[model samples]
Target: MKILVTGANGFLGRNLVEQLRNQGYDELLLCDRNTSESELEQFSQEAEFVYHLAGVNRPKKETEFIKGNTEFTEKLLHLLNENPNNPAVMFASSVQAELSNPYGESKKKAESFVQAYGEKNQTPVAIYRFPNLFGKWCKPNYNSVIATFCHNIARDIPVQVNNTETELTVAYIDDVVKELISLLEKSSFNETSVLYEITPTYKVKLGELVNLINTFKESRNDLSVPQLNQNLTKKMYSTYLSYLPEDDFSYDLTMHVDDRGSFTEFIRTPDRGQLSVNISKPGIVKGNHWHHTKNEKFLVVSGQGVIRFRKIGSDNIIEYFVSERKLEVVDIPVGYTHNIENLGESNMVTLMWVNEPFDSQHPDTYYTEV
Candidate 1:
């Protein structure tokens, strides 16, 4: 299908175009702010569908809002009406259009024009009043508060929040794009209401949002990962990572090295648990320790090893033979002293997951013989 997308370089336009191409759309008529009117007219004539995304939200002059939003939309509709083919139209309107501000007035006028054109020409149209949108490739320091916060916080710059208690309804860019695709496929709507609403939006407090973003920035040195079970935090963290500087994608972790081998912590979370890697040289043993409340699962990924565990007050010892030949997990129970001895000729690598992160202040660990 030939689809024309105005403001193709804008935040929503870029994401929509990229995803459309991924879904096997080849004939896309992309128009940005620099595209000439003559070119837009030609593209509109050839397009089977139109995504009218071009609009001015932040402009140098107030009057430019009407010119960019209302006047431009009027011209695009006029060109589409001249074409013999009546293509389906979709407009990226905003929830602010119901307000009395200049920007809102412009969007309101543009939305009215599109609806009128759709009724007169009998062309199908979809107008979306989006909330605060956030995702990758969004321009920082403009329009989107989430984008600005992510960019600034990642760079170690302080962010200023005037009303930290202010709440906002936000939508992820992927969700917006998915809804657009659905609109194209179904093209179903009620004649009474021309508005199209997207589902699964998230509501966040401004202060909480900033705090979550700050945690993402601090994860570099802390070797911690955010709690992804919360839907909003997961998406927010992903969006934050997308704005990181090119050279700062990776960070190194400190490995505790000794003659026996090395142990490195990879990730830690408050409630989810922690992951660490342990290396033991041949004939070397590590971890003659027992904990009061912590439990661990150890998986031998390389070489052969024997994990021996003994109850704190008992002489009975349980031995589990582990090797790279067969993957198996050994659990270290609470109040039990445990140790792993490398039995192979080469070094052994083990992946360990503990239910709780290690703390130096109150290290529940107590040294004992296994």
Candidate 2:
């Protein structure tokens, strides 16, 4: 099906268009400010679906809002009228439309026009009043506070929060695209107004948002991953990584080196657990310790090793020979003293996962021979 997307170069429009292409919709007529009127007229005649996303949010003059938002919308609707297909159109309106400000007024006017035209001509239309939208490609300092904070914090730049307690409702760009795509499956309008709300919005306070961004910045040194169980934190963390400077993508971790080998912590989460990489040189033995409450899983990723475990205060010793050739994982039970010894001619690498993040102050580990 032929689809026409306005504001094709814009933040939201760019994301939606790329996803549509990824989904195998190639017959797309993308119209931006540079596209000529005649081209838009031609696209309007052939398009089976229309995504009306073009609008002016930060205009120098008030009249530009009407011209960009209302006038452009009217022009698109009129052009769609000339075609016999009566394509399903989706308008990217804003939550600001509920207010009386200049930008809001223009968006509200455009929304009203779309709704009335859909009712009068029996055309299917979907109208969305979006809150602050954030994700990759959104212009920092111009559109979304989340984008601005993510970009600035990733770059070690300063960010200011005017009110710490100010709450913001935010919508991710992916969620918005998914919601718009879902509308295409409907056969007819179920509601009288043809207005629809985007689902799964995230609410965050200004100060808390700043704190989360800061933690993301410090994650490298702490080797901590932000808790992903929370929906907002997961979305925000993804957005944060996208804004990281290209040359500054990778961070260095200090490896503890000794005569035996090297140990490095990769990731730590407050509630989830910690992941580490352990390297044992040939003829070297490491990790002669027992944990009272913390449990661990060790996977031999490279070379060969023998993991020996002994129950505390017991005479029995259990041994598990592991090698990268077989790719096996050994579970280290709590209250058992364990040691991993390199059994091959080369260094052995093991990936370790624990149940809790390690604390220096109160490490649950006790040094004991296996």
Candidate 3:
């Protein structure tokens, strides 16, 4: 099917067009500002589906809003009328259309033209009144506060929140794209004028949104990442990473080094515990201590080592020789004193996962010989 996407270089249009291509739709006639009026006329004649996404969101003059939005929409729908295909339309309206502002007024007018065209042609018209949209490729400091926050917060740039309690509704770009594509399966339209809402929209306070995004940067140092299982946090986290400056993509991981090689904390979780990398010098013995409640799993990633364990009042010593040559994990159980000795000529690297983050106040650790 031939599809025509207006504002093809725009944030929503680019995302929607790319997803359509990914789903095996290649006959897409993308019309941007640079595309000639004749090209759009030709595309309008052939397109079976139309994504009316072009609009003047922020204009210097209020009149430009009408010309870019309402007037342009009328011209395209008129061209669509000259064709016999009667292409269905998915109009990208904003929730702002509910307001009395000039931009909103223009969008509301454009929605009417789209509704009339759909009725005249007997085709489905999907008027999506989207809330603030945010994801990759959205211009920072333009329309989306989430995009601005993610971009600025990722770079340590200051973000001002006049009212911390101000709540805003936002929709992820991927979610919007998926929902628009799913409309293709919808063949029935009970009426000509229908308002469509994007499902799974998220609500976030200004302060909370900033705080959550800040944790993404702090995760590198504290290793305390956001709860990604939560859909909103997961989506915001992905959007935050995409706006990171190319040169600042990588950050330094703090490493604690002494005579016994170096130890670096990789990741930490509230309920799942922490992962750390331990490097031991040749002949170095580490972890001559046992935890009362914190259990751990140790896997040797390099060199050779022997992890020895002894129960607190038992004389029996259990030992497991490990090396990178063969992969295996040795679980350190509670109430047992354990130690790992680097028995190789080179440094031994061990990856460790503990059941909890380290607490200096209530460190369940007690030094003992194993």
Alpha-carbon deviation at 180 in model 2, angstroms: 0.5
Per residue, candidate 1 scores C-alpha lDDT tens digits across 198-244 of 78799998999999999998998898888888888899999999999
lDDT of 2: 0.91
Instruction: Tell me which residue pairs clash in candidate 2.
Output: none
lDDT of 3 by residue, 1-370 (tens): 8999999999999999999999999999999999998899999999988889999998998999999999999999999999898888999999989999999999999999998887788788899999989899999999889889999988889999999999999999999999888877755443644788888899999999999998898887788878878999999999999999999888788899998899999988999999999999999999889888999999999999999999999999999999999999999999999999999999999999999988899899999999
lDDT of 2 by residue, 1-370 (tens): 8899999999999999999998888999999999999999999999988899999999999999999999999999999988888888899999999999999999999998898778777878888899988888998889788989999999889999889999999988899888776666656445566788877898899999999999999999898888888888988999999999999999898899998889999998888799999999998998899998999999999999899999999989999999999997799999899999998999999999999988899899999988
* Consecutive 10-residue window with the lowest summed lDDT within model 3: 184-193
Cα RMSD to the true fold for all candidates: 2.2, 1.5, 2.2
Q: Estimate TM-scores for all models.
A: 0.92, 0.96, 0.92
TM-score of candidate 1 relative to the true fold: 0.92
Which sections of candidate 2 miss by over 4 Å? Answer: none
Residue-level error in angstroms, candidate 3, position 124: 1.5
